[model samples]
Target: MSQTNIPLLSLKNISKQFFGSTVLENINFDLYPGEVHAIFGQNGAGKSTLIQIVTGDIQPSSGKIILNNEELKIHSVHKARELGISAVFQEFSLVPQLTVEENLFLGSNNTKGFFLDKKKLHQMACQTMEQLEFSIKPEEKIINLSHAEKRMVEIAKAFHTKPSIMVLDEPTASLAENETNQLFSMIEILKKEGIGVIYITHRMKEIYKISNRITILQDGHVVNTDSVSNINEQKLVELATGRNITNLFPEIKKQRGKKLLDIKNLHISNSFIEDVSINVKAGEVIGITGLAGSGKSAIGRACFGVNKIEAGTISYLDDVIFDSSKQINDISPRAMLDRGMLYLPSDRRAEGLIMEQNIRENISLPSLGLPKFSNGFIVNRKIEKDIVEKIGE
Candidate 1:
């Protein structure tokens, strides 16, 4: 994509302060038409704040947002959309009870005489999804859609407005490899249509894959801005973190220990794994890597008793928790956890932890029932706090 010299959108001397605390300091950035300008940063690097300013979710304390060489004052998201600007944030903003078409045109003038124009809505939804090359039915309920499909719906909603500039923040956070490729294809389509994309992500691979220009932001400050080809992966990491990862990595020691977990002839029904065998030893950091739907998560879920095994032998330290041939199936999540085997789900917000709880509460939640933290039923706050603090550290 060949971007023009004049930027479609520009943030000059942008600085934001909340409660007298400076979050963004003199940030200058640009987004040219038909350009994928990526912003790389660690957590608290003010990426969200910058996007919020661009989308009119918040106003900057100082700086000017120039659109097409003209000054623009965007006070809200509605105004931004009206000005040919749109954003697809990391969080999904769809109602679970609503259908895809309904969520796509939500808050829009899709009604005729107080009645929803279903045919027109469907046509528009399908058209926008076709443009994005996403496969999802218009009438499907949002609750029934998978994470990837939900993400696509969000993007489709944003793209339906036909914005000149689009902001995508961590768009591939929950998507699989194939789904990510699909998103990249859509981005390419956007580029061809002369839509300026401000992509914010922490993934280095994505930066090299799609972005034309890379801007590194560290501690809410712009460190460097250059072409992706000009900066390699190692250089990118150092620019983002201000340190080399090789110096932080612990030395690998070649030592073997007794087997802690052993699985043989594992077969999960309705999954990609037909026959799998693996052994985990003490003091071993085993990694099970595969593409989307390639049985990596299946194996972990099966070991945690979350997924039923059609045929397999799962042993934990010589204790046969599950053996299909022997007709012995006593595997349970509680049993696995009690046996010192833990599994973290892929969707942390939905399955792993309670989003409403604070960090201390979430950390102590799983250990509340243990003897050290609880006396029969009541929890010991002092002991729990002490343990939780150590675990947090």
Candidate 2:
């Protein structure tokens, strides 16, 4: 499709439902050549459902999906890819057992009829990684890579598909600023190649920075679609939330309470972090700000037992406490949770959420074993739904 002609992809009056509850209602949208289109919405607003339908992961109950003026029969995800559609899901779909090169060339590896062509696959993988300026060995196993490295590998894998349309679901959630910039550069490269991109994110700054157009979804319906130039940040937030987006960090209403957390001389090996010290007072909102690799997140992990600390002492007031002599590394995630410390990871889909689980289970998972529900060792089901409904709102 020409840049000035009809859109490369179009969706007219799309709708979806589950068990009589409508998730997406009469939604319409379009994607044009060389344009970065963004879809913004809160959780459960059908943004995922729309992506699923477009990528053939799910079928829409009603609507017409036209690509290049031809109606598409998106029966399955594999079928979508066959039609030059690719998605880097919010959830990591990578097979960690495989090498980075193998993950990159999973299905499209050059094969000699019945046999596999390993050499050509590795060559193509290396070339693609080099193009992204990602420093990682093609032969390295995915389990050996850090979170950022794994995210980079996923992007490399997406590129190997040679897609006409690529959907990135929160691509920058785990990426550093430099890595995000690199991805943006790659997106520009794709745009020049006439490929359409659908970027899904909650970060308004990203929509302002990279997207050419924006489509906002709320309560499973389309609110509006317009050029980025036509709307400002406040307007965009209103569209996404149906209300003015409040300052996420609100003012303190009361005096800071007793010290709830304290860390002294924290360090992690080989990572760009060392000798970090911080404290969190009861009912206090503490913000950690720094450039990537500056130990901002590493500190969070060390406190929650996700990463090992070479030396540190954490005192969580009377509720919980830790000493450097004890192996904080030995502290289990359950132990941390038991002590009233919960972590909301930056990568919500990959680390913070279980997409396969329904909305109810995910919200209730943290408190699953609590004594509130107990009848012959089986938890009461009624209370679970109540808890979920409260959180879902």
RMSD per candidate (Å) reads: 3.3, 3.6
Give one digit per residue, the lDDT tens place, for model 2 in 241-304.
8987677446768888888887777676555667777888877788987665676887777788
Task: Kindly report which residue stretches of model 1 are placed more than 4 angstroms away from their true locations once superposed.
Answer: 1-3, 15-23, 56-64, 68-83, 142-146, 174-176, 244-253, 327-330, 380-393
Candidates' C-alpha lDDT: 0.88, 0.82
Clashing pairs in 1: none
RMSD of 1: 3.3
Q: What is the lDDT of residue 310 in candidate 1?
A: 99
TM-score of 1: 0.85
Tens-place lDDT digits, model 1, residues 1-393: 663799999999899999999999999998888999999988988889999999999999999999999998899999999999989987778998999999999999888799999999999998988888888999999999987888889888889999999999999986789899999999999999999999999888999999999888888788999999999888888888888777534788878789998999999977989879999998888888876657788899988888989998989898888999999998878777788878788777767889998887788876676898888789888888888788768
Compute each candidate's TM-score over C-alphas.
Answer: 0.85, 0.85
TM-score of 2: 0.85
